[model samples]
Target: MTDKIVESEAPLTLVGGGWADRALLADLRRHAPGIVAADGGAGLVLASGEMPLAVIGDMDSLDDAARARIDPARLHRIAEQESTDFDKALRSVAAPLILGAGFMGARRDHELANFNALVRHPHRRCVLVGMDELVTLAPPDLTIDLHPGTRVSLFPMRALHGWSEGLHWPIDGLDFAPDARVGTSNVATGPVRLRFAAPGMLLILPRDALDPLVRTLLATPGAWPAP
Candidate 1:
């Protein structure tokens, strides 16, 4: 990773290549003005009529046409296979919150990599937006006001322990392992509270919960645990 950090005064949006929808980009940009694309995502950002602050990735998926459109100074090529474009952009950008679009819904592997990126860099607070779900790395401690019956699924990227209240299935006293047991399809009985004993928990909630989650992430005050 480069020593230079791309800091944003406001929340940032990461446009990826799994799937690009013009309307989705516009909506996300409304909240996150600073936009950064992940390789091929530059093409989608251009198609949406918005210029990205920078396009960061390995540069393999970036076609000549897309490269020609992006300012040379804004095009950052990491050219490393050990990490994906999503990883490159997330680690490079510094923002209070990051909302990622076009990173989910197309390929399962690509989506999974994006999730891996989220877990790998716990310091980056990013949420991946899909058609129907919003995935984010669960903070060390989180509290959200939600209506009863709202879906609050927790998927562990690594084995960890945590406690929760106001959920149909309490996460308390549960041994969570990535490959062994996952907490999915849990329902929120009311306003929910979560205290993660460690990092590596992934929080999946309904798409409509995106805005509230973003606000919660910003209002909460604490630095992420070291990876």
Candidate 2:
């Protein structure tokens, strides 16, 4: 088993080497004060004039200058080429919720991989913050209060079935699969409630919903067990 690099009771902010800005970082830190970096994400953390509690990655993208700035004890390198740095960092963290920035809005392929990592580690409740939206894996049962007409998109990583409330188009009998029917651009009629038969559904919401989503996930008792 991979040893945990960070164990936190409060939420953690995980920065990747993607398109993150100072405002995004500062906003995320407001909810999740503890910070960790994924590979070259150390550069972003340093640029923000703050140091991460730990940097977990393969060390390929992390530069020498950033390496020199960080304390040696905080750098935990895993010399394997199989997984992405996002995967490494996500798996190593034991937190109630992880707010990830700089993992989206850069490369499409990297953003896709980051989504893949979310489902891959269902036990880790993480929300990836983008410029305009936030994405997270739908827990076994989730309820969030959102305004009517809010956009709630659900993308499946694999085959699954689910039911919903407060969505304009319900997903009761729908068979969701990556290659089959996918839920996107769905509108909410009121407060939203979602229950998934499996652990592959990705919940996409507006960036403003991060706080309520985090609260819902933390309060919900139903979470996918580690596989």
Q: lDDT of each model, Cα atoms only?
A: 0.89, 0.94
**TM-score between model 1 and native:** 0.96
- lDDT (10s digit) by residue, model 1, range 82-192: 988899999899889999998999988988888999989998889899888899999988888888989999999999989998999998999999898899999999989
lDDT of 2 by residue, 17-126 (tens): 99998899999999899999999999999999999999999999999999999999999999998888999999999999999999999999989998999998998899
Error of 1 at 216 (Å): 0.6
Question: Clashing residue pairs in candidate 1, if any?
Answer: none
| Each prediction's RMSD to truth | 1.5, 1.1
Residue-pair clashes per prediction, in order, are 0, 0
Worst 10-residue lDDT window, candidate 2: 214-223
Model 1 / residue 183 / CA error / Å: 0.9
